[model samples]
Target: MNHINEALKHAEEEKKTRSMMSSGKLRSTLEEIKTEGNKAFSSQKLDEAIESFTKGIEVYKDNQEVVKLEKCTDLTKIAISLFTNRALCYSKQRRDANVIADTTYVIENLSRKNVKAYYR
Candidate 1:
């Protein structure tokens, strides 16, 4: 019974640690994903770029990361950029509805004044 309690406590601690995300690490991960997406975009690999950007968006949406940030505005701005870039990819693919949806997401969630979102 004593050993089981200790194991349970250790598992809980591990779960807590895994759920704690630092803002710096979160930013770094987002940037790395964005860079990969950018590379794909530059190579004219629209689909791959969209996939990478979508992954970046998912990372940005992680609750742990959002809770860790002191000011979530930075993340929101980054999300706007990512969505706008994805909209560009959709445009290249002639996926007009997707482009509109992505841009609208940025406009609604990030900022109405975002130039890229407006342009999209």
Candidate 2:
């Protein structure tokens, strides 16, 4: 029973990934979210900025299952940006743990040479 349930879950995940890949809206959506987050950050709305960045990160992570199936360097780059920007917001809020988690993700998964991430 567990095996069958696991197979069904995998099939469902694959179906969602294929649908998201076919839509082709992920890039534009992520860009919009990033822009909104930047605007919020510029306005010194740390909480709002964090919300936007977190939303962007969640969107990217949701579709990440298809990343291996289809190479999209742009998406990865945007995801990295989202994490970095969110880390900045966390820093401003004095949320050291959140900042560390986001920056660590960037350093480990995206760019080991990201000096800012290392510094954060």
Candidate 3:
């Protein structure tokens, strides 16, 4: 009984530490990447905007790997937004297939409340 209790206590402490570290650093980094993508889009720099969004997507994938290893749920709003923004850029560039692929990924894997994906 004592051994079981000790193991459970250690697991709880590890879970707390993982949650803290993941939320703080990962959220800020993702936010910065998303901001950069939005800024490029607003400036009418389509290529740069796409590049920024792509970087955000890459970071999002890395985040997912970490979340999986840590056995936690990742809040994926920003990641979905990154895909949506990339789709918008593709639409502007007349890349219909790419736009479709991105929007489909968001709609299928993320939230139904992402109305932007529907319109895209």
- For model 3, residues 39-101, the per-residue Cα lDDT tens digits are 999999999999999998887775675555565344487888899999999999999999999
Candidate models: Cα lDDT each: 0.83, 0.87, 0.82
Looking at candidate 3, the ten consecutive residues that score lowest on lDDT are: 66-75
lDDT, residue 99, model 2? 94
Candidate 1 to native Cα RMSD, angstroms: 4.5
Rank by TM-score, descending? 2, 1, 3
Point out the higher-scoring one by TM-score: 1 or 3.
1
> Clashes in each model (backbone N, CA, C under 3 Å)?
0, 0, 0
Q: Which model, 1 or 2, shows the larger lDDT?
A: 2
Error of 3 at 24 (Å): 1.8
**Alpha-carbon error at 115 in model 1, in Å?**
1.1
| lDDT by residue (tens digit), candidate 2, 45-73 | 99999999999999888888655557787
Per-residue lDDT of 14-114 in model 1, one digit per residue for the tens?
88668756777777888888899999999999889999999988877764345444776766766777899999999988999999999888888678898
Q: Which predicted model would earn the best TM-score?
A: 2
